[model samples]
Target: MSRIEVVAPNLKVRLSGVTSTIIQLVPVQARSLGIATLGPGLPEGLPKMRWWQVPSLLARPATRRMRIWHARRNVEMVAGLLLRWLFRAPMRLVFTSAAQRDHQAFTKWLIRRMDAVIATSARSGSYLDVPHDVVMHGVDLDLFHPPRGREDGFGAAGLSGRFAVGCFGRIRKSKGTDLFVDAMIELLPRFPDWTAVIAGRATPEHLEFAQSLKARIAKAGLSDRIVFLGEVPDIRPWFRRMSLYVAPSRNEGFGLTPLEAMASMTPVVASDAGAYAEMVVPGETGAVVASGDGPGLTAAIERYLADPGLAEAHGRQALAHVRRHFPLSREAEGVAKVYDRLWSAR
Candidate 1:
């Protein structure tokens, strides 16, 4: 078999947020940095190294280059330690922490072993033991941008002549899906021109919860106005069609849906979960309310519905805010700098 070898690079393990970050960052980072993944759940068309190939990878010519084992989980950090200490590989470990709460004993131990650490947001960094750099996640500007044609876009998606306020994410209690639905129920009657679209998948465990919300929407006699799109293959068009996006998550590591919506020039009414407060500018881009406050969410959404012009004005600012502050390229650049520091230290 032909051996696949590269200079100092990144190795991602496990299938979770870390894997998703790798997927989004690899393609862009690869253009200027050497990065690859070694795990399942990652799509094809991106570079990946095999588990069995790790030993061989350690044998390549040094050239003063050191592999960067960029771990986002405890297991991956352990794997990096084994490769460096046991196999004697020339590599340094780096970890990115997005957890908002306190870490367990074992998790802290693993984190202590890393050569460097990265936090997804400033709030996340507050929970870490060691000093770290804050590199907030960003959305793809090309994939998510201002609407080209709002009316035509809505019509293409089978919606018409309506103002859409959307809540997109997994359907579960933690995500505050019910909070959004309840708020919609209270406000939709006041504004006939506005509609609510809930787009996301409900896992088997949450099927009953999701169905209950659907039933409530039906019971309120606004099922037509309040739509539940289980899961969408492409959410970009949905965001483009929306005048306002609502993220009512009770908690989050660092939510990206709001960034995606803002990138699409859709104003947001989000709960102050994750880094949402940092992402949204109150009275400028959108409103941020306390999590689980149904009345607060209802009032915020009603404000946009009461004056469509406000939503439009906020959306324009949202697009500019995202464009100026958060872009996928900027995130990739931040990660690359971390890689450069690790590489140079070796």
Candidate 2:
């Protein structure tokens, strides 16, 4: 077997943007280079190295002078450091920062130890005290594409609606789930043909919040119109079913859902949080509203509800925009260059 030149560590077992990134990009990167993911919860299809293979990393590979350990989380960074410094593994550490907030002292310390750093967006890079490259995340074009026909998507969902508008993410205040529900409550009644879909799960702490939103829907007699499908296994098909997508997040660390929706040829109405503002092209692809502005979110979504033709045109533009700027291959290539630079410096 070829020695692994690059190892992308996903320390978290739960599904997240970081985990999704690894799952999507590693396969693309592996086609041209010696890359494999290390850690848990990844699909079996991807190229992966086992925990038992740690000993082999102690020696320098004949194919490369040193292995590159790419870490997306603090725990993953710490693991890389232990391998290189504590265990004397022949590896170079690289960290990717997606957080758009000020780093804690410990996080700052961990970052300083990395040989190279990558920021998911320019906004993310601003929060980093150290030098880093800005490499935005991308969507898999093959996995998410425009539906052959409108019914092709809606029929698969088995939902009763002529049109669908959706918001997908964790059901929590920070993610602006309540804001999405409020927007739907006000708009769905106005446009009787459109049904609002919310896909994601609320953890133990936010179950009450999710229930409260449901109660609000029931109180307004719009529970049937507003459907909640908790934590979907595959969300690509749902994106195809939507006529519009809303990312009303109050906070985020370079979110990817908007891009995924765009790739599905679904126009977006997103709040100016994370990289939503960066990803969306107002009036052309979609609109961007201020974070936590319930009125603005409702108004933005209403534009599509009022005119479906405009929405469809904008969806076409959105698909083209994402194809040009945010293909998964582009992201993999950008990340590969960073790895190449580290290797060249050796």
Candidate 3:
């Protein structure tokens, strides 16, 4: 076939938000355009180009005047710059910024050289000095849909709990894992039927932090009520098992776990961090509390725990909200428009 017209470089060996985005979006994007990824750590099934194929990019594609190089991280941005400026690749450099924090001098310099820029959320866009388009991340509806029945999820998890409340993602201070644990300790005793589940792993550097939370749970004598499932292979089923989900991150670029949970028919209690405030409709789909405010998080979570019917109603609304506004197809289409505009300009 057809020559590749788009190159999405991951450039990271470890699993991260950027890597996950590439994995989820590439297949949907590939259906519309000639797109392939370049990097390590990605699954073998995804369409990928080897380092040996880098030389081929120096020439224009047969069907297109120039290819698009999409970068989500600093290293990927630097790689795109090297390919276009140093190696004279016939490509247009594009960088997607998910950071809400002010950019460093070096990062600003790197961003200025990009041919096009995309921000994952409006808040993330506000931090950028350069002109950019806002394209929010979306969840895969097929992968994270509602379970057939509540017991279906409970059976899949093999947990002994009438109702489950979960918090997922890396267990770290920044992720606010301790806040979730604290909330569970205080509330689980009141709601004897509810169980708290924490999924995700703590890296070597954060092992002590994770252990401390577990110790806290043991001290509270709620270790059996509050469980930890480290770095699950698939989190969708776990999401379905939850009566409510908590995203207690102190800070985030553009968090997708809330949307994922919402898509899985789980109501969320998220913090103001990331685009959570934008995604969660206060008093509707879910509640949005201030970041790092443990008391506020506890109060918000208690709203759902106190009333299971409210949680189920919100979960239904959340799934509808995500389907209408945050489907993977919408994100793929939005990015495609950016690509189309760049190609049209050429």
Candidate 4:
């Protein structure tokens, strides 16, 4: 078998936030380290190997430095362990946990077998039983950054209003897309300069729910003002077109949209779901409101809408905050450190 080698071998068989994380991290990490993804559904540009290639990939002499099988899900973790035991692969297993709740027995048992565990946020770490590293997720600054002129960006995209408030993600109740629509219906009429945009796909399951939101917008006679542009091919420019971004998820593992908005130099109004409170600096980057509270969402968005200057000022801080604290390179470096320690110990 032809050998494929890498120090960090990422195993992701499913499409999810975990897959997104791997896609985001591997390209950046590959710049400085030997890393490759072993999975399906990752971006085609990423260096990847087939499952059948795992044996020779692990046994090659170039891989003698001791590699890592990084898993982000239970199935991937079990696969990593099996590779080591069943195939005698000389690689350590690492798992990154984003779940904030207590682990089930099977999951806890898997966690015990991992050589290292990484929590995406401090709050996530609190739920772990063993020692773990908190490596907060980061955004690709080059991909998600400020536009030269916000109005021009919006104009080019055919979206109206001088200032746009956007909620970008899956269009469902759990994501609080309905809450965003409610807040916009209440606030959009008062601020003509500010239009609300909801850009996301409503799956077959949530199509009715999404349609209900559209009906509410129409009933309020604000169809033009409250635009639901459904999922776009590129979310970066959509973010740039916005002066303010909102994330009103009822719950999250580690919501990255707020961070993406911040990186794009757009001020945010996110609910206290996920690690949003930790990611967004209240009054600096943007405000974090109570989750599922319509009045609170209204009030927070009102804060930004009422003072355009405050939103602009906070947008500047948002850009700097992301650059200083949450660069994608930094996250890759943190994971590299974990790999380094695992290599040394093994």
Candidate 5:
């Protein structure tokens, strides 16, 4: 029998850096301040820092970076709490972006007891009555910038140049990819020239769903109407090719993709869920529809599809919103400040 013990150390620290892309302007700063991160796919460029694998903690029984624990998802918080209890240490847990922040008393209380708090969106911060920081999750600004060609390339991409709607990212129910598909099915007949390009992989459930969606499109004889560019590793071209972007996610702690699409100068069509309200302004930077309503999604998409020249105007507004609100270094710097403050206190 091979067994291992994890000594949670005098001060156990947990870090979930799954969202922190190494090249992003902010994460570089957090690592410099010794924020021990644990999660999948850490940036290889990070220095020889003490990064403990949450699962491998059982064998090490070491506790060096156990002072300031920060995470993004609920799963990360659970792992941090267990580590703190196992090590008999006082933990300062900070969840970067949480979905169930409204009615999540247990999760909220568990995190509030910690020394500090952080939220990625204003809505997430609004609920808490504590000393909290709203540091949005950032994107690779260099990678996602104003698209080239017509600034309206949708014209060339088999779209009417008036109504080219695009949505990318993993195909899933939560992402509302299904909603987008259904909306397109209902609206495409009215505007046969309008195109909806669905990109990215699908979950097992949605794999079948994706197939069904494809079947429906084919059955409706819309093989050319709705294009499926599945799982594109290089999404820049897709962003550049579309006049409008769509995100119907059921929920999001912080919708970074819309930000990325905005940064790429693509006007958005998103549900008023999670970070969409903060990012997309109805009839402004982008359009917003009621959450869980397929008709709303259809109407919002059609608004931009109806007027693609507004794409440039709408995209510029979206870009300006992102520029004024969320800068790249914001999240990492806030996280760094937390570490500096905590470290200095110690």
Candidate 6:
């Protein structure tokens, strides 16, 4: 078991959920793989100081004490470069943002200096100008697998009779939740049994926008057709209740919710952003829409809602895709091999 330290410094609530999923993956399968955090409140119940500032705060001598570091996100690059210089901590930087292209050259340069790299998808791989490997984020098939309705609260909440189209993950403009809501308004007349749900935490910047969304529901006379269940600790129960899942992200390194939806056997309609083109496989595993196309989202949602057998077919195909290309063991093994190769080079 090789110990690896992950240093993602996010104070946001949503960061914890995603990072926790990653931290649990590398260590559990890689035999004692470990993480050290540097930032304001990390995503998981991580053990370490708020390392968000550690890169900028560390004294030269202090940095020399550590051996390996994992920098999370592109924003942390400056600190990553400084630490690499101070400690020679053969670091492996992970990037999930596709929003920045102007810095790609510099990012590529910095990545090449690192011992190795890990990309979540081919789009994510393009950020690297060095030796790297692709490791699809692994989902706990058991935890997220076809969720059983052990309790009735999720269903009994009166969302049971409708075609539930739920979206999960951080709520923000980039996530395109507003666009999803607009599409929901369009579908209310055609599909009276449809409901759109906004799950996960929304940023303070978007809180007013969420209110506007709720107001739109009331104004459109579709309050009965839409709902908002704010952030919850465990998503399994929520995922279980969903009949169809939607993703309208302006961007994604890789959308984990769609896979979670597939694991739950809920059908998916997603924006063709980042890795969705490769993973979703329109008309096969799931339906996909243009990033901001409300009509496309509405049309795709209607298609899936109108055809349960097709939804099941696409969902089954999605399950098979996950089992073949993105299983935890496959992802873990790919990453372990990369670690082995990097160590060999050292």
Summed backbone clashes in each candidate are 0, 0, 0, 0, 4, 6
What TM-score, computed on C-alpha atoms, does each candidate reach?
0.93, 0.97, 0.98, 0.94, 0.78, 0.81
- Considering lDDT, which of the candidate structures 1 and 5 is the better prediction for this target? 1
User: Alpha-carbon error at 126 in model 6, in Å?
Assistant: 2.9
What stretches of model 1 exceed 4 Å from their correct place? 1-16, 60-64, 150-152
As a TM-score, model 1 comes out at 0.93
Superposed model 4: Cα runs more than 4 Å off? 1-14, 57-65, 149-152
Best by lDDT: 3
**Deviation in angstroms for 261 in model 6?**
1.0
Candidate 4 on 1-346: residue-level lDDT in tens?
2233243444555456777787788889878766677766777888777667666644644644566778888888888888888888877889999997899999999999999999999999999999999999999998888887734376776766888889998888889998999899999889989888889899999999998988988999999998878778888888888889999999899989998998888999999888888899997899998889999989999989989899989999999999999999999889889888877773
As for TM-score, the candidate ahead, 5 or 6, is 6
Kindly report which residue pairs in candidate 2 clash with one another: none
Cα RMSD of all models vs. native, in order, equals 2.6, 1.2, 1.2, 2.0, 6.2, 4.6
What lDDT would candidate 4 get against the real structure?
0.85
Task: Residues 106-175, candidate 6: write the lDDT tens digits.
Answer: 6666666666567777776775566567776767777777655545224655663555778887778788
lDDT value for candidate 2? 0.91
Candidate 5 clashes between residue pairs 3 or more apart in a chain or in different chains: 8-87, 11-66, 12-66, 13-66
lDDT of each: 0.82, 0.91, 0.92, 0.85, 0.66, 0.65
Clashing pairs in 4: none
Model 3 TM-score, 2 decimals: 0.98
- Kindly report which residue stretches of model 5 are placed more than 4 angstroms away from their true locations once superposed: 1-26, 30-36, 47-67, 78-92, 101-109, 126-131, 149-163, 344-346
Error of 1 at 54 (Å): 1.9
Ranking by lDDT: 3, 2, 4, 1, 5, 6
